[model samples]
Target: MLRCNLICIGKLKEDYWRKACEEYEKRLHSFCRFTITELPESRLPDNPGKAQIQAALEAEADRILNLTANTFAAALCVEGEPVSSERMADLIRTLSLHGTSEISFVIGSSFGLSDRVKEYASIRLSMSAMTFPHQLARVMLCEQIYRAFQIINHGKYHK
Candidate 1:
């Protein structure tokens, strides 16, 4: 089975978000071995300066990189290439065919990811140009990943 790991920063404190993630994870069981690893987000003040935010993102990147070792890394960022659901499914299939059974997706905190993280990514994916709450992003990503699997399998869940 393919191993899909979602390495995200920050915890999902909302019940709804957790429930939503759990649902997708359950649905994905037949497709791939999935795991969600939440890393600690760097603390910042109410009004942090650019430098401080950059520093924090760098720190988070270090942790993310460490956790994603030995996997094909994909970083979720606003500047990343946006793809349709079908394309995502194709990408997943291609990776699997290439013998990359382990795929890791990195989701940065509110301040976003550092350059180092982006550089480390084998592919950069963007959900949208608009910003979303990190917790909610996790749920969305999980759903999309499940949908991708369904699409690959020609299952009705994706349609």
Candidate 2:
């Protein structure tokens, strides 16, 4: 089975978020081997300056890069490419067809990903034009992945 990873810098603290992710994960079983790798989010001050946030993002980016070095990396950020569900499905299918067995999607903390991480990604993905809490983004991503699989297999869950 293809190994799909959601490498994010933080954990889901709320029961509702966790439960929602769990649901999608459960649905994804028949499609691919899925896993969520939570990396420690860097500490930032209450009133962090630009430099401080950049430093923390860089630190987190290092860890993200290390884990995703051997996989197809996708960075989720506000400025990333806006793609539809069909496009996402196509991306997965195309990657799999071209010898990519592992695909990693990276979600940064509050300040978002560093330039290094974004530059490293094979594709940068934007969930939407509007911003969302990182925690909620996680759940949304999980569902989208499951939906992508359904679309790929004609499983009647996407539409």
Candidate 3:
């Protein structure tokens, strides 16, 4: 089975998001081995300056890199290249052919990812140009991953 990892900064504090994520995770188990890791978000004062936010993002980037050091990393960003479900399926197949059974996807906090993290990504993926809360993004990512698996298995999801 394919091994996929998700590294995100900050815990999901909302029960609804947690439940949604769990549901997708359970579904994904039938197709692949998945691991989701959450890192602590840097504590900053309310109304923090740009510099402070950048510093926080930088710190999170360091932690994320270490967490995903062993896998091919993809950073989720607003300006990243978008791919269709068929394309994503193809990409997964290509990865599998290259003997990269393990792949890691990283999502940053509300402030977004640092340049260092972006630079390190093997690919950068964008769900949409519109912004989404990190919690919702996690659920969406999980669902898409499950859908990707379904597409690969010739299941009904791609239709």
lDDT of the candidates, in the order given: 0.92, 0.92, 0.88
Using TM-score as the yardstick, the better of models 1 and 3 is 1
lDDT of 1 by residue, 22-140 (tens): 99989888899999999999999999999999999989988999988889999999999998889889999999999998999899998889999999899999998888888888998
Q: TM-scores, in order shown? A: 0.97, 0.97, 0.95
Candidate achieving the largest TM-score: 2
Ten-residue region with minimum lDDT total, candidate 2? 150-159
lDDT of 3 by residue, 1-159 (tens): 889998999999999999998898888889889889999999999999999999999999889988878678989998788877677778777898899978898999989899999999899999887788889989988988888888888998768
- Report the Cα RMSD per candidate: 0.9, 0.8, 1.1
Ranking by lDDT: 1, 2, 3
TM-score of 1: 0.97
> Lowest-scoring 10 consecutive residues by lDDT in candidate 3?
83-92
Candidate 2's TM-score reads 0.97
Report the backbone clash tally of model 1. Answer: 0
Q: Candidate 1: list runs displaced more than 4 Å.
A: none
Q: Score residue 21 of candidate 2 by CA lDDT.
A: 86
